[model samples]
Target chain A: MIALYRVLVLVGLIGLWWLISLQVGGVIIPSPPATLGAAQMLLAEGRLLPALGDSLITFLGGYGLAIIVAIPFGLLMGAFAPVGKTLEVYVFALAATPRVAFVPLIIVFLGLGVEAKIFIVFLGAIMPILINTYAGVLATDRDLLEMAQSVRAGRVETFRRIVLPGAVPFIIAGLRLGATIGLINTVVAELYTAVRGLGGLLALYGNTFRMAEYFVIVLMLACIGVLVAEGLRLAEKRLVRWKSGS
Target chain B: MTEPAAHVVLSGVSKHFGHRDGTPMAALTGVDLTIATGEFVAILGPSGCGKTTLLRLLDGLLQPDTGSICVGGAPPRPGPETGLVFQSFRLIPWANVRDNIDFALTSSGLSLSERAEKVDEAIALVGLQRFASAYPGELSGGMKQRVALARALASEPQLLLMDEPFASLDAQSRELMQTELMALWARRRPTVVFVTHSVEEAILLADRVVLMAPRPGRVIESLPVDLPRPRWGYDVHGHPSFIALRRHLSERLRELVLTDPGSDFFQRGAPRS
Candidate 1:
């Protein structure tokens, strides 16, 4: 029943798109089926898959590095106030600044290669992951900490049982945000100027005035991005089902 | 059946909180308590009554301003010797029941096998063996509290401090847990200190209920409960002595409540006998 409803919605959306294209006087707005056909052509030629893969690898690297650095640092900041205060403003100031502005400098330092693209992805993803992890750590239940203390839990034991456990939900929420932004950064950096990935393809197709191909690439990217994000969400639910009782 | 010995002694224990200006706000002053090993004692008070503070004092979460607390023959320190089961269950969100219980045994000088064995025993002891792998989010209020109890007990702590462990459960579940607790007590009785607002619960589960009226969080009364064990849910309410005891404590609590805020929650002509 749900599938049928979705299919009906998709049909209606397609019909509306077809009607709009006919009414409009330009080649800019391709019909839904035409856009879908273009999308298929990209898939068949194997260009889209490989480009997506390239984008995905760089995206994961950036997001992965963010998680590695941001989370432990966030934990330290949250668990220890003085340390948090010391490092807090540095991250906050960095996060507040328009990271996009750094792209030019980053290109200068790292060149317009995968390194630059990955760096942008890292910068974009790191803040959400950092902020979320810190929030999660701070949000840990004080009562549980008391309980842990009462049980004669040592410092490390208490952190393991209570502090880290409490931060998991927020950490996952942060990861979701990081992945979303990281994907966008991958495409944005590539579209701006880069050697490989979907963004580079987008720029190449977009500049050549292959409007149909551009539309198709955009659609394919949207699907993959949505699927990856949704997949993470599903994983979060399965892995963090333990959060429900809390 | 016998005289309960004092297991943990708090001598002149006073706790003060520092304000923003570093001025002290007294939470407890000159608190001298002697908790007997294997005895179930309840601390009864209102929301601000510092009953929970006293429990924390025993747990070593907070230090007293001008006194000392000794637990299980040592000065109060952070470790599994003083187990606390929180009113809200406070189960770790990332841990299943088994892992939560296992956490207590992690640093107990026990081998991995020993830790696993202890966890199993604790789970079985709580009658939550079936829910061992279940996450905190999946458990009911009662079940979550049971996990807390199991976790606390797993380390074989000589002292257990409970802050309204049954407070969040429904009345029926609370009553059931009360009996379950009594049964657990009968088997492996630890020197237990429970804090609660429920008048009847204090009488039902405790050997002595230390009542507090709050402002300064001092003990107003220490009433001994002389009820025998093997108590069930129905039996707790049905006994004549239980009724009389409940009536007295409830009346005392009612008096305390009605005196302040000028609003009465009790009936004008409620029977005392």
Candidate 2:
């Protein structure tokens, strides 16, 4: 039933877009069919798939790197009081600052290439993952820790069995947030650095007044966002099933 | 009757915590006690009497600021030899009943099959065989505590330290758990030190009740309960001895509570009359 409503909503949105396009004309606004035709043209010309692949590479590289570095860093910060106290202010400050502001500086260091793009994505994604993981570790139940200690579980064992499992939901939440932000950063980086991914196509089409192709790029980005978000939701559900068992 | 050998001994034990303002606050002061092997001892006191602290000290979770504690003729340390149950059932919420019990045996150096056997035995002992795969969140408060108990018992600890294990349960569940605990104790006969604030609970289960006073928590008296074994089978509560001991302990407890300056009633300067 919900699926049927979702399809109806999609059709309604397309109809509204078609009506608006007729009013504005094709140069300013593309009809749904025009956007679909442009999507096919891009696919046949083999432009869209390659651009998408480039974006995927940049997104995965930076997002994956953030996961690797941020989780342990966060864990260390949370597990040790002095490290957490010293770095907490800086982490918060950096997180509060606009990530886009770092783009110029990142390009200066790494040049306008894949490295700069990856770094930009990494910078955008790392904060949420690190902060959320730190909070998760900090939020681990005291009673559970004492229980582990009472059983003479060594530090490693306690961390593995108790702290890590307790923090999983937060970590996944962080990952989900990181993923969305990472995708946004991927586009921002593509635009600012060497023109390469879907963002490049968007810039190219918009500048050339190719409204249908521009709409195709925009739709593709939205589709990617939806797919990624839905995937993470499913993963979160599977990982934290114990939480909802009752 | 010849007394069994002392399995646990604490001498001149003192533990203090730094208050938020950095002032030293004594949790347990100048505590001295001994428990015989295979004995069931209850440390009964009001809140803030450091009964939980004493249990932690015995479990080697916290070190005493001064003096010494010995369990099984060695300096106290938590291992497979010691099992502890908290007031809150501290079962890992993510781990099911069986896995939670299995965690206790992680450091036991037992192989997988051996650990599984021990876990199964504990589940059966606690009558939780059907809920072995159930998570803590799925279980009721009473069932959760049973899982906690089972986790502690899975290791077959020589010293079982329980800190108000059933205090969170409903009244009916509490009664049922008390009976089940008695049966388990009778069968395993581990050296047990159970902590609680309830005088009646102390009298019903413990072979000896060590009364503690707050405001620098220390032992005030040690009273022996001479009630017969299989206590649940008989109307132990209505027994003449049970009545006398309960009355005496309750009076002492009331006196202690009223006199303690930190107690709410005393702090409020409530009229005694």
Best by TM-score: 2
Error in Å for residue B188 of model 2: 0.8
List the RMSD of every prediction in angstroms.
Answer: 3.7, 2.5
Residue-level lDDT of model 1, residues B12-71, one tens digit each, is 877777768988766777777788888888998776667888987787777787878888
Name the DockQ score for candidate 1: 0.56
True lDDT of residue B240, candidate 2: 93
DockQ of each candidate, alpha-carbon based:
0.56, 0.74
True contacts kept of each: 0.75, 0.73
Candidate-wise lDDT, in order: 0.81, 0.92
Q: Candidate 1 — which pairs collide?
A: A151-B79, A151-B80, A152-B79, A152-B80, A244-B137, A245-B137, B14-B65
Provide the lowest-lDDT 10-residue window in model 2 chain B: B264-273
- Clashes (N, CA, C under 3 Å) per candidate: 7, 0
Candidate 2 has a TM-score of: 0.92
TM-score of each: 0.87, 0.92
What is the C-alpha lDDT profile of model 1 across A1-246, one tens digit per residue? 998999999899878878888898338778777777888898899998889888888888888888899999899999998988788889889989988989889989998878888899999999988988998888888777766665556788788768886787788888888888888888888866565787888888788877778887787778767787788889788877766655
lDDT by residue (tens digit), candidate 2, A1-246:
999999999999999999999998978998888899999999999999999999988998999999999999999998888999999999999999999998888888999989999999999899999999999999999988888877878888888889998898899999989999999999999999999999999899989999999999999999988998898889888888998987
